[model samples]
Target: MTERPEPTFDPRALVRSLPQSPGVYRMIDASGTVIYVGKARNLRRRVGSYFTRQAHNAKTQAMLAQVADVQVALTHTEAEALILENNLIKELRPRFNVLLRDDKSYPYIYLSSHQRFPRLAFHRGSRKGPGRYFGPFPSASAVRETLNHLQKVFPVRQCRDSFFENRSRPCLQYQIERCTAPCVGYISEADYARDVRHVEMFLDGDSNRVIDELVERMEAAAAALKFEEAAGLRDRIAALRRIQERQYVAGARGDVDVIACVVRESMACVQVFVIRNGTNLGNRTYFPKAPPETNSDEILYAFIAGHYLGGNAPPELIVSDDMTDREVLEEALGGDAGHRVRIRSRVRGERRRWLELAMSNAEHALSARMSTQASMDRRFEDLQERLELEAMPERMECFDISHTQGEATVASCVVFNREGPLKSDYRRFNIEGIEAGDDYAAMRQALERRYLRVKKGEAPVPDLLLIDGGRGQLAQAEAVLGELQLTDELTIAAISKGPRRRPGEEVLHIAGREDEYRLPPDAPGLHLLQQIRDEAHRFAITGHRGRRGRRRQRSSLEEIPGLGPKRRQALLKQFGGLQGVQRAGVEDLARVHGINRALAERIYETLNG
Candidate 1:
């Protein structure tokens, strides 16, 4: 067989043959990797400029030297070319492109449409489900905050479909007046439907209409001699008025997004504030990965194209910086949204104020991010010097165990790296088949499970392993590593509280050393150790509490004699939950439909005991 001849590239020859049409271009190096992606209205002129231009930046000059092949995909229009460029950039992630690291979808407030009493909830993924979505809110917490406020004012049901279907009585939400207990027929269908309509109107930015209708209902109830009903309606109206006052922008209506970008020392921060129906739905900060020396306008342009093209672009965008491609972006975004979109840079009054606020936030966020990075670098250096390691530890894992009286024990492992806490690598193990209150056994089991995976090459092995107890816990970790034949690969240390059990008075015990090492109260290395150990403790306690709560919520009621699922559910519904049941006397328990005096007494005794 004969080998093919090596292919050679000539930029001038390629540019000569290129057509003068709108298209996307990819510059590939000799190794067959795309190093840059771009779009142009006149492909021939744009491609020729790279070879003809005399004044090029260092980055561009370097890119030009390595460009062995240039490819182009023709499009019908500049807008089409812009979209194709974004798609290709996201798919290929060329080294020279301004990449947007936004992988998570925005959150929305979903209102179910099929149910008789529709439910409101937080949604974050695909919108193919049968519901009316009210937002592409910046974050899940913002969606939840809006939902909570809506419930307080509208008394609409927000429970899951399963919970609503099985309800036999009013739940705690109804008692707290946040819901009307539509599941149990506490509110008539007509009245519930009215409330749902009001919720819809409020979310649609028609709060004035909702308040007006509510005032009419209040007057009607008063005229009908229903004083209690009138009072409730009056209170709902007041809450709605208060919320409207707080949320509505002074001179803004409809949907708009305020976007600001700040670039300093090759780092950039972008802040986006969402406004729907004139209400501020909160803001989120994004730090997109871009090549060095990229300006704010370029980053803002890339962000708008990559972000809004996914289909949730508002009608108007108030940007902090002016971009040369503003018209092209507006056209592309408008096409995606099926409406006209506008990008405004020079504004006055309220919109200008919003832009300034977004700019300020971006500056602050970038400063904090840079500070955190500098601090992390300093601490990592100090830790390396203190531990006498051969090099800086790139990854460290800390293990801590938590339990209450040996029940529902949980072992948590928190990982940290040079950048900071690596939350994605954090793990929690539910320890089993161990003697109660045996921290050593719990630690041993957790390490065995975790390292078994590391041995199989399933996870990265950390350079350091920090245990959260004294010599005993450290011994368990050492034994486990020895069994796995990984003792020589990583360092081991344990942190234990000093004699007085205080923050700055902790002793660190290294595996191969006889005497414990103690650092000064203000040592950076000690501060780093304390941060990781405290995080492990927090994670462990959180897991332990959740496991304990779920176990008790189900087991405590099931253990009682003559208390089947029906009786237990009935008691829970009447009293609201397990804590309410625990607080109720035997007489109060017997008042439930299925519980008799004898069974009630038995339940009280079992729960109280």
Candidate 2:
């Protein structure tokens, strides 16, 4: 088959032939990668201005320098172009675009409708389940707090369906009065349905309606001389009223989101305060990735498009900065939400107060982040000086081994960059086929596994590698790197405790050096190493403990002949725990579901031994 030829892209010729319509444009580099994406009302004027304008910002100039071709897609209106631009940016993640990094789905409170006794629980991800979802809550904690409050006022179940189905009697929730024990027939289906309705009304922001109905029920029960029933109803009404008072924003109603963006020292922070039906749900913060030249207005514009276009936009957005494309964004968001969405910068009353608060929070968060980044930079600079390196390292990795006696060994690799710990790049390895307590073998195995990926270009090679032990562990790392032909690609060092394994008294052993170096107790470079080393140790120990716990949790019954997973679960659930199962007689174990007498005898024998 013949290979397809590259398309001829002449910028001047393309600009002349472009129509004067609203559209989105993409800038491509020589490698055929999209470097930037943007939208404009007039395609010709926008595309022409790039080449005609003499005064461009540093970021735009840098982008222009790499542009080998320009591509445009026409639209009927600027709003359409705005939407298309957002989609392309999300899909392509062009290098120059202001991208929102936290795109995880927001949490919600789900009320199942498909079950006979509907369940209330915290939920995230796809809404395809047959349920009534009552939020796009700012965070999981917010959803959990709401669910907790609802459980206190309503006797609805929050347990998983499997647990709910297998119940032989009331669980802790029922004993604590948080659940009506529908699983054990303590409450009739009709009564449970009524409670579920009250929950739905409360979540829908009709707290006053729910309170009114509860008051009516309380009076009726009082008149009938049912003191206990009346008291419960009265308590629920009072609790709901208290909740409304706490959640209601003074002089605020309807659905609105308060958004504030602050840009400083080449970083940006966006604070979002979500309000639904006059109730303050909570606030969330985001740090979008952008260049230094991008302003708050541009960041706000990109954030609005990237965030709300997912069909979770509130009816009105109160913003801290005035966006140039507010009208276009409003149109796009409104179309997605099926309502008239407004993006407002100028506001008054409680909205002004909320906007101010959001702006203050954004400023505080950005300041704190920048302060930490500055500290990290200082530590990195000091480390470079101490190590006598040609330049400051961009990334560093530290390795540590953790185990108890000779069981469940684990090696942890923690990564750090100039901004501090890069947790996403941290890794843990289960050291297998080696002596249980062999630190050298564990280090060698982990380094080989990690650097093999680096050698194959699957993972980035760090500028420096640190070992948690002294000379022996360092030798393992050096040998591994030498085998992988990466010895010259990075520096290696080992940190050994000076005495009593105390902090601030550690000796550093650099590979290829004859003498060991110890930094002053207060040295910033030493502190940075300590931080990375401590993190690696913490990660390794955590992994080792988890592995050990899982291993111990596995019952000896698992090894018994003809004992399957179902029978094991049945025995554990019936007996409460492994010790309980172990103490049971063979005849008692035989009574568990799916366990025949022969299998039960085998289980009893194996567990006893």
Candidate 3:
């Protein structure tokens, strides 16, 4: 193998400039655009690793060759570097990085402690101000479920602290038996405080004690002949039982948090089950990205460190695989949670059983995901063969144009990388230099503009270009690309509306073929194309409808004959729209503030007599 000459730019100079401390590092291009972001324990040595000839892969080599400048932010510790890395990646969103881009903020159940009488509420984000925040729950419905259970079992008031303090009488919550109405002094302050304590206990996993108290209350109410009150207590007890019923996977013993991970190539799945007081709160699965060469321990170590860095850390974590630095992880999480934490591999007894179950789930989930991806790959290959392309189109770009009766002309390009739709790569264009309602012209403009960047090496060149149309539209796109001298570099195809828009009967337009090919209604390859085409149509239509809506907002019926501004406004205000007026009777249109009977009758007849 021939050795490539190194750049004269001194990495030692860069390393010497960096402080020998924990920090986050950035590799930037000549334009100062960051190509990759990394965290380092020792900034100099860590950044120096990229310059080493033996330590580089094709991806990292490509990243390094593009680097023109290095940026570093010194942190207090390696842990701080990790946190800063996640934050920066989330913000900058550099290429060659995997991220949790779901945009969903974890939910929490907060019990307000600021007022004389506390109240429970569902919340997301921080624990700022005064409140007892209980989750970072997986979903809103999960928080609601726990809230329902807490309200029934603990008698906690679900209201704002301000509302609780201002109440002069029992509210509807009291009538509905959802609350004890401590806001109106229906329950004594001490008793309410006791109820809050019980809630805290329940959340803290003292389920047995909480149940004992509820049972005692029920017995006391029954002995006093307050059977109605006793019945309410019975319901509370049943609710607790119901909660237990929902948690069917509860372990026999141990407060063990079982962690399992599955890895296939660069993709990884981490499953964590939190068992507190022998009840499984729940199990959550995380798909973390790791280097292919890295073993399970390193991945698991990094995963645990990153996972518990911002969330609640369990006391005892049992993993399916061993971690490189289990003690360091335990110490780090222990400091965060203000408790002694243990991270260990599977042990004997029920803890091991939980670990096995979690591992099983991880394996199944990973297998299913990989299977789905493989099927998509097979379909993509089949699509390429059917289209008779030189190579498979792993990166397909589909173009669609949407308009409403020659108004709000817009075009959209949806890019599908090897995975399903890369929504981030989707682009929308406003058509110009073309008549409105001219979909072929609009598509030509979009493709020309899109490929102009591809020629300049500013945008990725897709393996295949897909236009939503028949031969006429495809020819328009072909001519545009041909004029730009880009037709040979790319394969273009067109998808027209299937028979009666029946998905599978789609017509595929190829460049040289006189007649378009039709895929059978039942072919898997055809179904795949239909899905992609439908998604593109849906995306374009949505974009066009949004533009149309804005245009409509700026339009008025006064533009038509016999409709003055005032009368049009009156009609719109009364009937909402032409459709509404069409559905309305003459009497209904006449009921408008400014509409007379004759004009209203005329309007109704004009719409739909």
Can you give the TM-score per candidate against the true fold? 0.65, 0.62, 0.53
Q: Model 2: per-residue lDDT, tens digit, 493-545? A: 99999978788889999999978889988889999999999999999999999
Which digits, one per residue and each the tens of the lDDT, describe model 1 over residues 1-609?
999988689788999999999999999998999999999999999989999999987768888898999999999999999999999999999988899864557777889967788988767679999979888888655665677678778888776777789889886567667788899899899988888888888888888989889889899999999999899889988988888777878888889999999999988899999998899888988888788888899999999999999788999999998999789899999999999999999999999999999999999989987887668757876887887765467689999999999999999999998778999999999999999999999999999999877754457778789999999999999988865545655789999999999999999998888988888888888899999999999999999999999887779789888999999889889989888999999999999998899999999999898
Candidate 2 Cα errors over 4 Å, as ranges: 1-10, 220-225, 373-609
Superposition TM-score, candidate 2 onto the true structure: 0.62
Q: What's every prediction's RMSD, in angstroms?
A: 16.9, 19.1, 19.7
Q: Relative to the unseen true structure, what is the C-alpha lDDT of residue 390 in candidate 3, on a scale of 0 to 100? A: 57
By lDDT: ranked, best first: 1, 2, 3
Query: Model 2 scores what on Cα lDDT?
Result: 0.87
Regions of model 1 farther than 4 Å from truth: 1-5, 223-225, 373-533, 536-609
Q: Write the per-residue lDDT of candidate 3 for residues 276-333, one digit (tens) a residue.
A: 5666667666666554544567557666665666656767778878765466567667
